[model samples]
Target: MLAPTGWSGRFWARTECSFDGAGKGSCTTGDCGTGGMECKGNGAAPPATLAEFTLAGPASAKDYYDVSLVDGYNLPMMVDARGGAGGCASTGCVADLSRRCPSELRVGDACRSACEAFGKPEFCCSGAYANPTTCRPSVYSQMFKSACPQSYSYAFDDSTSTFTCSGADYTITFCPESAPR
Candidate 1:
């Protein structure tokens, strides 16, 4: 079997493989296919490579430049550390938001809220499990209700919890659109 081309993980391209300018993903979001190119100023060479996707492209009126079609290809993103250019390198590129941790997750957001909504309590930050044990079995059970409620009452070890499903830090294996409305 010629390893099923685009048979396993082939995803649909939002447009003819190109950069997305809309930012909000009104257009392409992933898998730009396998195109390649190199771009530059007017005197630039006739692109030794072609681009696979336009992060923001000539179509969107972003400054035209060349890029490789290969995914994870490294290109010198415009701007330096501290997100500036020239002089002290330490200060430049600091402001570049690409590849940095997102603030929402870095902040206090957690699946615990969703767990509480489902009725599971004290599942995430149970604090100290000794003494009064705020994470008591009752609360733990409640937390599980919020985190994973598919079959919370069952002794079945395979049953899942709401916290397991809604965690942003981890991808919880679940049926798409299976959450309660």
Candidate 2:
């Protein structure tokens, strides 16, 4: 698919899906709740791995991307940048968080973030804990960071999690080490 210049969007894969001829179905993980193959502009449910992007725009003049587990984690993913300048580094989370998932955060093949599991302001980085200073990483977020150093473990994990590039193409690979070629 050719994304026009300045296009911005996110992508993810749904696991354990079942669809009929009419294209209606649900997935065990990353279900957008649209009840169909197409998400129809709907976002994925929690515990779904995501590859987010904001292509070069007038305001920034550079592309930004990240693999975020702030919502949760369902699988391993990696983002590679090709032919770009200005910190065009590869970034992603290739760690299988499911095996290391805490008991409280485990959801079948997925792992819920602290915010998704408890909805606490501290975990969600909301209210008084909206900023980086007030919302230090919790034990749960710390664990995620320790496992997936390149992923956005919490809401304020910007310095390392977010990456930038200019005039580059990106490849988002799910389960990068083992995905079918």
Candidate 3:
């Protein structure tokens, strides 16, 4: 369960994982580097799709969230904020990015973000291009955005990527079905 205050974290899935009878195993993608199934206060490895959330804090009553491909993408995911203020809605990337991922960014079954694939200041939005004004989306980021419009393809994509809610519960799903027409 998530708290109404002082809570901030991310959620993601690990793929191609195999656990032994004693719960010891590893994953090909999004590994937490714990050498076990349990994360145990560890963060996921690169090439992961992240659903990040910052719950309502003392200064605000709104909950902010976003599905980000900034680190990369290992699986399709969705986040639905139900019964909240500020037009809370569903946002995610349902596309199978691994299929269309650029050859250079392809890492096994996952798609690596341009910043991860190419550690350049421009692609990473670092150094001189650290600010939003200078860090515009590159061609690689645009490709990710095109495939997943509701997700953060890179840093400084908050304008259209970030979302908010209040007094609501969230539903996160992996490989969610298509919405009814």
Model 3 residue 126 CA deviation (Å) reads 1.3
List, residue by residue over 157-179, the lDDT tens digit for candidate 2. 99989998999988988898753
lDDT of each: 0.22, 0.89, 0.90
Error of 1 at 37 (Å): 22
lDDT of 3 at 20: 97
Weakest ten-residue segment in model 3 by summed lDDT: 172-181
TM-score, each model?
0.17, 0.94, 0.94
101-181 per-residue lDDT for model 3 (tens digits):
989999988899888888999999999999999999999899989989989998999988999999878999987775211
- Any idea how many clashes model 1 has? 32
- Segments in model 2 whose C-alpha atoms lie over 4 Å from true places: 178-181
Q: Which residue pairs in candidate 3 collide?
A: none
lDDT of 1 by residue, 63-156 (tens): 1112211111111121112222222121001111112213321212111122233333343323353333343334333433333233221122
Better of 1 and 2 by lDDT: 2
